[model samples]
Target: MKILSITTATNHLSVALNDDDQVISEKNEQDQRNHSEHLDPMIQDILTENRLSLQDIDRFAVAIGPGSYTGLRIGITTVKMFASILEKEVVGISTLKSLAKGIDQKDSLIIAMLDARNDNYFAGGYFGQALTNVIPDGHYHIDQLLEEIKKFSQENNIDQVVFVGSGIDKHDELVQKLGLNYTYGSESQNELHAGLIGKLAVNEEAIDPDKLLPRYLRRTQAEVDWHKRTGKPFAPDSDYVEEV
Candidate 1:
């Protein structure tokens, strides 16, 4: 099966074309400001280089969120549109899970996280080669995540904890303070890799394009400000428009 996967959940944007287990072509760069402009062109470049078209793709996969709000929307919207128009299978892969898969550690706790700023993170924990979900994915403070990791590690008799994703860069010192045997992922492991996303989608069940949505773990700044101004909970689909 030919799978086209996209990852734009962070500053790093990546696109991959995979044929079954083989990655045919991939293009990636660090461009946080212009993901919308680069994503489609990268996709086209890969397809054209392979002598294929969008119609030839059998499945579409995308990183769903817990990163940049705008980046997530752009990637999900583009993939959904293509899948809907082509009537192809669509898979939404978790950004954290993709990071976890990038790490090749066995018999240890694998924690995949994205820096959510202000000492908080979007984190999920997995174990072993199958990437068993030991810690649920969600927004968490650095201290809270550390406590959970320590508890899970002690209780499960696991000695080492492997941390992956951009979050490691910020919280490694705090993780070290716990006095546990922990390691940080490599520079490449920290970046979002669309090839891993495609491999993960191969076994996952496909969902309708209409049902696909960005998995933003927290409310946007705009929503928070709106709530504070009106003293009412902000709904994403609410009938509120700001006049230009």
Candidate 2:
């Protein structure tokens, strides 16, 4: 299947055209402030260069959250729009899973994380080449995440742990202190690769365009502040208004 995948879950923005599991073309740029501006152009460039149009794509895939709030929306919304318009199926790849898939490791626990700032992270653990979800993806404090990793490793008898994603650089010292044989992902494995996202989507069941949604593991600052002011608990479906 020909899949067009997009990743904008972090500062890095990447788009790829994949024929089955192989990457045909990819474009990546580091632009935290300009994903909105670059994403559409990158998609167009890849399709145009490959001599294909939106209708030629058999499937559309996008990283659906646990990263930049605005970035996730941009990518998910764009993919949804295209898929809906073209009447094609859409797959929402997890940002954390995409990071895990980039790592070429087996027989070790892979922890994929994105720094959520203030010593917190969005983390998930995967095992082996099939990327089994050993650790459920969620927002976690540094201490809590480490403890969970230690407990899981001990229980499963997994010897080494591989950590990947934007979260590694900031928490390297803390992760090292865990006393487990662990290694940080290489430069290439740390960033979200759109090609990997496309490949991972190959076996996943595609859903309607409207079913694809951003999976932000935490509440936005706006929602937090709103709760503080009104003393009301914020829920995912809460109708909190964002101030412009």
Candidate 3:
């Protein structure tokens, strides 16, 4: 089976093509947010380098995110469009889950965190290779996240955790203040990788292209502002109003 995966859920954009044997091609650009500008060219480069086309892929995988909203839209839309055009299977994998899969720590808690700004983050906690969710994935304040981590660790008697993603740098000092043993994920692991996303999506059930959506955990700024102006509570997960 051949899988082509794209990840633009963070500041980085990564693309990978994998066959039954191994990853054939993988490309990454860090500190770049122009996913709409660069993603197509990057995909073409990866496919051309591998002597394959979009039609050659058996499955399409995308990191449907809790990262950058614009990035997620671009990636998910691109993947869905490809799947729609080719009538191929498409799998949407969580950005946090993919980040956790990049960590190879044995029997340790894996915490995936991506910054959401304003002292908030998109976070998930997985334990060991089983990928158990210790703390649920969602937008969280730093203190709330820390409290949950503490509760889970104390309850499970786990001493340390394996932390990964760009949010690690943003909360390094705060995490350290917890006085719990923890290790920072390697620099290579901090960035999103499409190969890892592809591997995780291998056995996932494919959905219709139209059903795929980016997992934005919080309300967009415009939506939040609208609620403030209208005296309506900002409910992100509820039915969204079409922006005019």
Pick the TM-score winner.
2
Q: Mind giving the per-residue lDDT tens digits that candidate 3 earns over 1-244?
A: 8999999888889999977427778999974798888899999998898888888999999999788878888899999999999999999998999899888885778889887667777898998766877787788888988888888988988888888886666677888887788998898998899998888878789999999987777667787788779998766565333222
lDDT of 2 by residue, 1-244 (tens): 9999999889989999999999999898999648998888899999899999999999999999778889989999999999999999899998999999988777889999988778788899999879988898888888988999999988988779999987666767877787789888888888898999999999999998987888888777887788789997666584322221
Candidate 2: C-alpha RMSD to true structure equals: 3.2
lDDT of 2: 0.87
Worst 10 residues of 3 by lDDT: 235-244
Q: Is candidate 1 or candidate 3 better by lDDT?
A: 1
- Which lDDT values do the candidates have, in the order given? 0.87, 0.87, 0.84
Residue 38 miss distance in model 3 (angstroms): 1.3
Local error of candidate 1 at 35, Å?
0.8
Assess candidate 3 and give its TM-score to the true structure. 0.90
Model 3, residue 183: what's the lDDT? Answer: 92
Estimate the Cα RMSD of every predicted model relative to the unseen true structure: 4.0, 3.2, 3.2
